[model samples]
Target: MSRRVSDVMTRGSRALPLDATLYDAARIMRDEGIGDVLVTLDGRLCGLVTDRDIVVRGVAERRDARHTPLGEVCSADLVTIGPDDDLDTAARLMREQAVRRLPVVDDEQRPLGIVSLGDLARAGGVDPGVLSGISQAPPNL
Candidate 1:
């Protein structure tokens, strides 16, 4: 059987509340050496924010990072997968959606873990067999 996404997901991923300041969120990401952070609301998955979000949306707009809330800048329309999803499915979803990170959620839509391209790359070879299916199939919604 193919490896499951949960097997590769980074558990206890650093996360932030939607109401948190952009500066706070950025600090967490920088300290963790991670590019993305899951946005939560009362311990439930709401969206995701990335370093690029700060640079492109916050910095470019000249907004005060300390004053701006993460929710305002986060991508609310998130593409996610359940922990039971296969690694291949995660890879295909990432490629089709043009997202580098995928949040793994539980039944209640609570964030359980996160998977990134780096994780996939490091764990598997460049052409990780897990993603071969994605390479063959056309993009599907």
Candidate 2:
């Protein structure tokens, strides 16, 4: 019912190694003005680390932010979609997973780009209000 993910996805998401310190991820997020970043291990997709992850899993837990690797706290149970997949698939994935953002992957499950709820709305395939209500709606309102 819509274009492929690659047609609308924001390509080349900002990424960092799984071993990166929580401080490192936070710094990058701040510098990039992004809420989340793709996490990797040995140059492959591993998990996703968001600002909330750092706050709840790192700060709230009293972990050593400078020493703790993101892999320890990032959300590893990802819901991803292929670059060639339709926006319908993306919408369904978002609905079923209850996530606001999804990592678009290549055939080998390598991170290629990212698609957010807004992307679907912008694509004109889904209801904006409904998608916006999903978890992690952009803080800007």
Stretches of candidate 2 off by over 4 Å are 128-141
Worst 10 residues of 2 by lDDT: 132-141
How far is 29's C-alpha from truth in model 1 (Å)?
Answer: 1.5
Span of ten consecutive residues with least summed lDDT in model 1: 132-141
Candidate 1 regions with alpha-carbon error over 4 angstroms: 125-141
Quantify all predictions' global Cα lDDT against the true fold.
0.82, 0.85
Give one digit per residue, the lDDT tens place, for model 1 in 1-141.
777888888999888898998999899988889887889999999988888888888999998999999988988888899988877778878777766678999999999989877667755633565455444455221
Model 2, 1-141: lDDT tens digits are 458989989897888998998999999899988888999887778899999999989999999999999988899989889888988788877877788889988777779989998788888866655676665444320
Candidate No. with top TM-score: 2
Q: What's model 2's overall lDDT? A: 0.85
